[model samples]
Target: MATNRATKSGFAAEAQRKVNAKYSEELAQECLEWIRTITNEDINCGGDMDNFYEVLKDGTLLCRLVNCIQSGSVKKINNTTMAFKCMENINAFLETAKVLGVPAQETFQTVDLWERQNLNSVVICIQSLGRKAGNFGKPSIGPKEAEKNERHFSEDKLKAGQSIIGLQMGSNKGANQSGINFGNTRHM
Candidate 1:
């Protein structure tokens, strides 16, 4: 049973790694470039999953990235080989990312990076961070977020909408059960 569980775990990890690999090279490169732009630090990764994970596994780069967007957000980055300290850095970065408009759903857990469980999630988090970079006067990564469209309506139009049947409620206007027959009533 334990062996089966281990096999399943291995399969799941391999699958996640492959899915992470599917992100466009252009996107990964763009994200790396954006990170350099914001942090003003040169990263040595080749934008591949392995390189990306290695460069960021310590959470130093991530802390720096978030700090670039919001200064003093992490307060202090523990630059040490200790595992717990590294986890702290990641946690700080995640929290700061949340404050910087990177949604909680977009953030990755420490284990996701530490154990290489889902580096794709880390990449996605960085992409989201890049999108929000523009708000903080930094160059954005990936595509720009869409702008909202505001519509104005007169009071008459607003009141009229309330009386109309909603699409979800559906309309029976052209839909009729008229002359309906289940095969032939005599055949029953």
Candidate 2:
């Protein structure tokens, strides 16, 4: 008899355990609440991975969430259950997130959410979106977004910068070769 994924012990199970360690229930609850409030629709999904995957697998809610963040981010949300259409919606949402300054590393692949391969990644993607919401002057779900600090340099500062070399590129401004000479140096 063949065992199902839930019972089978394998690499998938090990990976899931590792990811689960990093998953935060508090954050997930916040993400769900934010989604509901922003889209004005209650998500039937829960903090559980299985339920979360099932609801988001269709990608309709994800599209709606993105559109709420930025109007017209996702033009068409497929209501049909076709696999490709669902994937398209997920892909569109991810693309919109990237365009809006969400780091690519923080996003998930289509299969990660659709196939339930990595639901934690999906949560992380959602959390990243929440953090970025402030860019649009919208409410956020997770921690407050970090503000951008742009520094301005005067003409003198800019000229001084041209004459100085950055320390990263082997700029030996001070003493060297004082006590630790190697490679066939006779001892004094």
Candidate 3:
């Protein structure tokens, strides 16, 4: 007889750990309410089923947001459309920052704020809080930019960019923003 290697119910889902760190329950509730309310909106799925699904896969991610909302680890800023854009998903946690209350436009206007304020952490938080959030809209580098920088490209790479390859050159930021990465094809 073979020993049982697989277990049912996914090996008894991990137990919920107590939230040891301090968190604002009120803010989390507000964020969840926002997600729930949006779920019932035109963007939910029924209005533009295809696009909505394209944006928010099933209601599963939305549900996880609700749980985070109930946890009060997130908050809302005046509850406006722009606010929704900035803090709609896991990004809501950033809304708790005092500056977030100062209107989304101004708060996000300064690139320095994004860099110094740890916007990357906000992005990571969104990724962790929901099934998928930060992964959305990751820039894709194109072949043209790649050829412009790579200094040497085979026939394949040249054909991909309509050039002889290795003939052109470009700046790092230009190549990156173009979504060009010789090492990573996932962006392609």
Candidate 4:
């Protein structure tokens, strides 16, 4: 009986390995790049917002990345459909930026200082999205209280991490909440 159980277990393991092997490192990198592109297009920190061409170009690239992700060519690393939907919204925002003609390299500088500033903005947005997703398993639906908490958490996180977004008294109060308070958010 033990031998039979071992054989069954081995078979199941092999099947799981096969499934895992289908998702390659290249695919994972593509997903990450797509996410980064979307974030860069959506968020910005103080810098050079002067180049119309670069902004438009970056917005276009951002839109393309979103299109690929939503087309299902790039499978999300996380096994959550809501993530897929978030990607869709991300794509929409990129398109909006493109239409608005936001400059791509607005933060470029002769030195790494400005580049780091821009990169930090991108990182902050991604981290905020990650925290929200982590706290509320479903990006689309969380308890009203949970969503509120996430917003407060995201605000505090951005302020703490980004020098540009310094913590204000309003945000401090929001961050200091002891429990979740669902005033008006809805679950998806």
Candidate 5:
């Protein structure tokens, strides 16, 4: 019946909406803004912003590159020979990593754009790479210095308040007790 078909179609539409809503609005906006700027200035992609926004939000690097190539950007390469070469290089890198005992996931494959049509992967890879690279360069601190910097929450653990009686004040012994002791506190 016509009513049955309509109900089924409506349900399908609602399901699609729910699936799409899983992606955050902030992420979608970031992708959209990046795509808008890149397509407008960097690549002369002829299509409307909506299409590019949607594709970029899905995060398919190959699709983005293809879009750029179609836009006739000098910076974007679109040859099958080049793609094959890149794939070979990627395979070599993976093999080298494996030999080196590097635990990397071999996720990327030769992208056959013609066969696989959907570009639904989110394109947040660049941000993650930046974070990893940022962490890789910093030198770690020693445990003692780290302990000195550790914060204590208990009132008893609080450092003793500033004391007038000390070695600086010509006292032989250092202040023995440690607590919230307010001793003859004078405002400078």
Candidate 6:
């Protein structure tokens, strides 16, 4: 029994080491520090920390953002329109982070994402929260809330369609009057 237990423990340790080897220890630690700072959670470099690294590797939105930042894919362009579009993407990403349980207000406490220099740091913070939150990050809405939203959208669409039809009818009336005016002017 002792030999069996020892073998099992050895295998577990080996598996952990392999997992740890897959991620950059420096990056993982940096991300953890940001997580601790933002969430005020007491996280360390082992135990639950390993789970953070695992989650970071799992390719969530935060992870993808980090990958984009790290790969130099997201950069400032000279074009104003492109820059505005980039800001829009960042805003959307931040909102998504908030929905995913990232304490976004606290995360941005020390840095502004609009500044290009702070983007990499922002990515680290987001990725850290994504790692810590795991499956809990997904936003949940009750079925009744969803149905209410659907009804509201349908009502808005119906109102828009009615307004468009009214505009078309008004334009047709103007066209009929213009035809009558043209015939009278020709006779005159």
RMSD values, in order shown: 4.9, 4.6, 22.0, 24.2, 17.3, 21.7
* Candidate 2 lDDT, 87-108, residue by residue in tens: 8989999999998888999999
Best by the TM-score measure: 1
Tens-place lDDT per residue, model 1, 92-175, is: 888888889989898888888776667677788889988888888888877798789999999999999999887898778788
Per-candidate TM-scores read 0.78, 0.75, 0.19, 0.20, 0.27, 0.28
Tell me the lDDT of candidate 3: 0.32
lDDT of each: 0.79, 0.81, 0.32, 0.35, 0.35, 0.43
Q: Write the per-residue lDDT of candidate 5 for residues 39-119, one digit (tens) a residue.
A: 454432333334543343222333343243233212333334443554443344333323333234422222311111211
* lDDT of model 5, residue 77: 31
Better of 4 and 5 by lDDT: 4
Clashing pairs in 1: none
Worst 10 residues of 3 by lDDT: 137-146
Error of 6 at 177 (Å): 98
Order of candidates by TM-score, top first?
Answer: 1, 2, 6, 5, 4, 3
Ranking 4 against 5 by TM-score, winner: 5
Write one digit per residue (lDDT tens) for candidate 3, span 1-188.
00133432432322211111222333333333344443344333232223322333222344344334343434332333242342344233334322222224322222211212222222223223332222232221111111245577799876787754353564355344565466875743
| Residue 81 shift from truth in candidate 3, angstroms | 2.9
Q: Show where candidate 3 strays beyond 4 Å.
A: 1-43, 46-70, 82-90, 93-188
Clashing pairs in 4: 48-106, 54-104, 55-102, 55-103, 55-104, 141-188
Which residue ranges in model 5 land beyond 4 Å of their true spot? 1-11, 32-76, 79-188
